[model samples]
Target: MIDALSPLLILLAVALPLALALAAALPAFRARALDLLPFAPLPSLAAALLATEGARVGVPELLFGVRLELRGEGRLFLGFASFLWCLAGLYARSEMRGTQRPTLFAVSWCLALAGNLGVFLAGDVVTFYTAFACLTFAAYPAIVSSGTEAAYRAGRVYMVFSVAGETALLAALMLAASGAVSLSIGGVSASIASLPQRDVVHLLLLVGFGIKAGLVPLHLWLPLAHPAAPPAASAVLSGAMVKAGLFGLMRFMPGDGALGDAWPLLLLALGLAGCFYGIAMGLTQTKPKTILAYSTVSQMSLMVALLSAGLGEGAAGAAFGALSLYALHHGLAKGALFMGAGLAPLARPGARIGFLALLALPALSVAGLPLTGGALAKLAGKMPFSGAAETLVTLSAAGTTLVMLRFLAAAGSQAGSGSERLPAARLAPMIAATLAAVALPWWLFPALSGQDLGYVLRPDNLWSAAWPVALAAAGFLVWRRAGFPAPAVPPGDILVPLTAALERLRKPWAAIHYPPFPKRRSAQLRARGMKVLLASERGLLSWSLAGPLVLAVVLFAALYRP
Candidate 1:
């Protein structure tokens, strides 16, 4: 099946971007290439849809056996992420219309798009690594394109973390591959749980992918990086690129609960911590993008927790299903939010209300409002948890609601100077993305779960989803009535201490130059002996003294140690 669709997958996974890149090389095409960026991802979207049945494309000689495969999970990931890329590209052409260095931006977009799509389709370790590398490195330029000081700092932090992540992933992959018969993702994943160094490999892979997933302690780059990038870039960064880390986790780790490793529990703890941590930190942020960034942290944490719990319970199939649905919902919703952040400010007052309505659809959905994509996602992911764990999962929706409300407040504050409505380029994509977020789940749920829409629409499920959002709304009202000011936690909250510690160490280290060892009498005597030894060394090299020395060494070796 994979072999049969290999050609089309190759076109979507590799050839489309290569062609765009080639076209970008010509000056005639380069001038207007930004306009064409939105379309570059269309092929990928098509392939993702067509290849839902599954496909594999590989060439043994290409970059250590480059191979691309699309199964159900990969297909869903590809379809959703590719959809985001396409919409973000549409948003970008207008968002970045008069921006500097358009050509550089266009090239980066194309490269990153290809890499992002390739990751979902990747079948082998080498192929996945290549795709991950492309996505990671190619995104650097996009992040720093603003040329702001903050953008530069964000890019630096992002690259530092990215390099560290790649290094860890490479090590983990090498270890996993060493014990595997085949280097494909499935083969490596199957072998990982049984490796002698499985724990170490697991840790490395977790930290490696966790950094990309924006898990706490390793998530400092996200708030800074997301806000620093253009809205379109932020959309992909939050919506699609970050999902790569989650994909890595699913691909490399054992999800079947059969591994019997303690790592899954640890992952669950990290995920739970991140879920709350992101909410606490996000509320303190004043920027819409930063709020969204932290929101991503919170959201992905739930995913990490879900996947980890699934692994612990040995329900790999169920875990992947939940992750797929959740990711699809998030990719579209978050992408729409980021784009709407940009569009909201540009929209006229009369039209802005409607735009805000559009924005709220996804925002509320993200908070698990009943009948929305988020509710479907939340409900679908509810399978792994029961008892208290399940309650905690449902209540996390309140935190999401708070974050969404905050995002709206922040975005609304940036309304443009003119009373003009949103431009078609921006408005069209935002509307499309939001609608997709709302409607896609209904269509996809049946296919993915073999369950009807009625499951999510059930009264109990709707109630489970609604109360958290309602609680959050009430909490917001109380907080507003009390007039409590939001604390101003800076973006990259934990990074401040780390930076200060580095700065504090800088002068102390610079002040202390190592002095030459004290020239005591013993030292002078040792130096004299060293000079005599050096004088003998020259004669030894001349083969005069060397013959006796060589013979002495041979005799010593023959005598051996007592």
Candidate 2:
């Protein structure tokens, strides 16, 4: 009887945000909206905790055949995401409290969270895609919070990629619905064995989810988008939001099939490439948040590889559940770390130790270092690897260590940022989140996967975790000793060349927009002056007159020549 109530709770969770968004116009709630946005996820957080450990959350039909459902894995993801939303809410209160229009941001945050958690709870692909699409674009305000040129650019790029990726997912969903399991992710996953268009569907789903997961080439937006937001927002964006992409892949794509083998291999290749690529670029970053963003790219790739391995072995159950936990820990720890980075400038001498301690949790967790949930997350991933995947995992661990160590070094060197006096609302949530990151995995492991907690604390495991950090630290020392400077290349290396090429293309397009089109700065001024003319009376008259004049001239010349 209680089990049946799970879905109702999930629906109510989503309703909280939807209701708040609708009620924003209420004069009484307008000012209170900011206070309500974070707690909007409370229902979801409760559902996540209640339903995560194989809770048989029943599906309730919505529309003709669609189901708004919450399964175990779904509940698990919802739990983490909702928790992040709650934490971010507190952070926003502290950080963005003084902003001009808090309601707008509050509304965006609640709506985005609703959509984010909804995607996971969605039983069918359409519902999932709808929720996902909501999150993908609705998050724009958070990305563009400061409204700087850089912020706008980051938000724009994020919006573009998000649209492209969602379109791909939607198309794939339609195809899956056209003949297969009627669009339910569970249905598709079940019937994927008999599906004729399996390979095509797999690849499309991979690409669609890959874009959000920050897979190479498609990942151009992470470093830009993550650091562009406020500290708490950045925490959730990096930690929880990106996981939606990966979660979509895990749910939508067939985890194991002869035809799907190629897709997993493709995922493996991309994950490995992303792992190394993130580390390479991260080493050059001067900003702690930017470096952490790059580290997310690398670390997330490692988690992707874990899912690929599960798919390779046909352990969909483990694959889905483990990735949920992985996302859970990474989100909390990463959020904490980023939030902690925001505090570097204002921490007192007495508080500095506490702050570094806060920052260290995620850094170690991300590196898969022992005594952290991140280490457990990696240990669980080993279930699917034996030979070559082992080597790949090791390299990934090494890469994560390098990137995180670099991030710490960079963050420590500054000891100061633009902001001062960390707010309690922001500080409290991160601390709570970090504590949760430490304990949740251990608590949930027994019920979710039945893995012994003892394994997480073993000496050999600690040594295994330590070696990667030791080696990376040694390398950092050598590089520093040799006077090797961190690369002076700007954050988002590809943005420069991409921007230059875009300017070149815009020239031709602008030419088409206006006669003689726009060429440069001076031409731009003339176009602004004549924009009215381009669409004005004089412009239409001139075109009409020119057409007849040319026609008359042509007719006269032909007759005279004859």
Q: Write down the lDDT of every candidate, Cα atoms only.
A: 0.85, 0.76
**Model 1 global lDDT (CA atoms, 0 to 1):** 0.85
The residue ranges of model 2 lying beyond 4 angstroms of the native Cα positions read 51-66, 191-196, 416-421, 447-450, 457-459, 505-562
lDDT of 1 by residue, 1-562 (tens): 7456655765566668857866876798988979778888887787776654656666777887778777758888988898898899988998887889888888888988888888888888988988888999999999999999999999999999998888778778877998999988889999987898988898889989999999987999999999999999999999999999999898888765656757777887888889989998989998888999999999999899888866866477767888799999998999999988877667776675666677888999899899888888888888778887788788788998999988887887775434876789888888888999989988877665546887877888889898899999999889978989999999999898889999998988899988677669768899999999999888779775575457547545754888
**Residues 1-562, candidate 2, lDDT per residue (tens digit)?**
5577676677777778888877765788887777776678888888776743444333446544445666657777777888888887888877777787677787788878888888877777666777888888878998898888989989988888887787667656666776764666777666655668766667768778888988876788899998898887898888888898888877766655544567678777888788888888888888999999888888788778767766755576776667677778888888888888777777765566666766777787778777777777777766566788776676677778878877777767656443555567777888888888877887776555546877766787677777876787688789878998776657677877998999998988787754564469778888787887667656657674664455446545744854
Runs with alpha carbons beyond 4 Å of true place in candidate 1: 1-6, 512-562
TM-score of 1: 0.89
Question: In model 2, what are the clashing residue pairs, if there are any?
Answer: 511-517
Judge candidate 2 at residue 123 and give its lDDT. Answer: 72
lDDT of 2: 0.76
How many clashes in each candidate? 4, 1
Considering every candidate listed, which one attains the maximal TM-score?
Answer: 1
For model 1, give the 10-residue run with minimal summed lDDT.
547-556
